[model samples]
Target: MDDGDVLTSAGVAAGLDLALHVIRRDHGSEVANAAARRCVMPPWREGGQAQYIDRPLPDEAGGGTAATREYMLANLDAPLDLAALAEHAKMSIRTFTRRFREETGQSPAKWLTGQRVRHARHLLETTDLGVEEVARRAGFGTAVSLRQRLHAAVGVAPLAYRRTFRAADHVRAAAAEEKA
Candidate 1:
């Protein structure tokens, strides 16, 4: 996991993720993605090392939902229900659902929800946007939904999460200033 200045990984595959994350963070997604393609790996895997275990790789002939996953990431605010996702994957709804779960160990809804929550948290930490706007952009559609999801995810309201991260950042900045 790439936690700010500290990056840690429990296994070899996770180390690859950590390296890709650093590349994505420093260079940009395009560069990281190209590197991933060169290495024949997924550009990014959202969760921790635990999620990497026992998941099937995309088929050698390239029949995987990776492109759909990338599309989903690119359009987080879009309504990406099972039908839409199935269409994007060019598979039947049942087949897409089964293959997605087999490849990712998570249902489509579950994975999409996790991605939304992660996006919401990123916006909260990095931007001064209002909660409702954050909610909308994160695809929760409403503040109430965002609150429910984020609270379920991190045990805090959106504002509290923002405040905590901002406070920590402020403290870090102040400490760095003193060092300078």
Candidate 2:
């Protein structure tokens, strides 16, 4: 293949995997991993929507909160504490605490919970991984924890969320196929 030329699989999903592979090659694994993680995409795509998924934005806007927001989003699968986040933002725990609430209109803990829930939602939609794995990846740490958080966020269990979204996807796919 020439420099400008590329090869891809037959399905649109395969094309996305090829694009992600190129991204991983060009930008290094960390960037590619973050991109994939934010979209709740698996490292390998086999008829999946990783390539076509829209990336979600973090809550914080520009200014001092930008760096902290990036740090939070990048580290969602890890334990996050207010002190650590404040330190990352290079502000005192007190000031950072206040600013975080002012900027995002949610406490750091609440924000983190929301982020995790969002991640969980994505995982439910796209991946076939079990709820435990989804919980871990979403930073919930355990299925029980994920259940509580997801319930709080959306008033439904993770499995139910998966079933709902998956069914929805299937219906959409059938409709599209019929049209085609």
Candidate 3:
């Protein structure tokens, strides 16, 4: 589950993801990617969102909203409505929405918002960016929106979340130094 120092998972796939998350936490993404390749697993599956998905990640080459999702992820700050997403996917709005829900088990808006929240959390953990900037980048438009969404997702505001991550990082660093 990854509540700070304690990490647990519900299944074998989740266990693999937990292990990969620990590798990424300690050794970084490249190391985690290499380890995933050695094990014949997808290089990365976001730990937070995967847990709630009813199905597996879509096969991008086999056709689905995968390309559109990639586009959405890259342009989180852009105004991405159903029209934009449908256009990107080369499908009608109804088809795109249906396919997106089928693939991801959530509506396009919900999935996008979740991705933005996840991005904001990552930024909070890894950067010193101000909340407003993080909000803008995460497509929340304002600090208040970021605060609301982050609170809804993680039950904490942005600054508090950052502080928690920072404190954890400090603890990890201290333990590493002690070991050395």
Among the numbered candidates, top lDDT falls to 3
Is 2 or 3 the stronger prediction by lDDT? 3
lDDT string for model 3 (146-177, tens) is 99998888778899889977998889999999
Best by TM-score: 3
Candidate 1 lDDT (Cα, whole model)? 0.85
lDDT of 2 by residue, 1-180 (tens): 115566556565565666677888889888878877886777664442222234355444565777888788788899999888998988999999888888777788887888888888898899999999999999999999999988876767888878877998889999999999
Assess the local accuracy of residue 151 in candidate 2 as a C-alpha lDDT between 0 and 100: 80
lDDT (10s digit) by residue, model 1, range 1-180: 557778898778878888898899999999999999999999988663222122233453554788888888899998988998899999999999998888777898988898898899889999999999999999999999999998887778899889977998889999999999
How many clashes does each candidate structure show, in the order listed? Answer: 0, 0, 1
TM-scores of the candidates in the order shown: 0.62, 0.63, 0.64
**Clashes in model 1: which pairs?**
none
**Where's the lowest-lDDT run of ten residues in candidate 3?**
48-57
The C-alpha local distance difference test score for the whole of candidate 3 amounts to 0.87
**On TM-score, who's better, 2 or 3?**
3
**Model 3 residue 152 distance off true place after TM-score fit, in angstroms:** 0.9
**lDDT at position 6, candidate 1:** 89
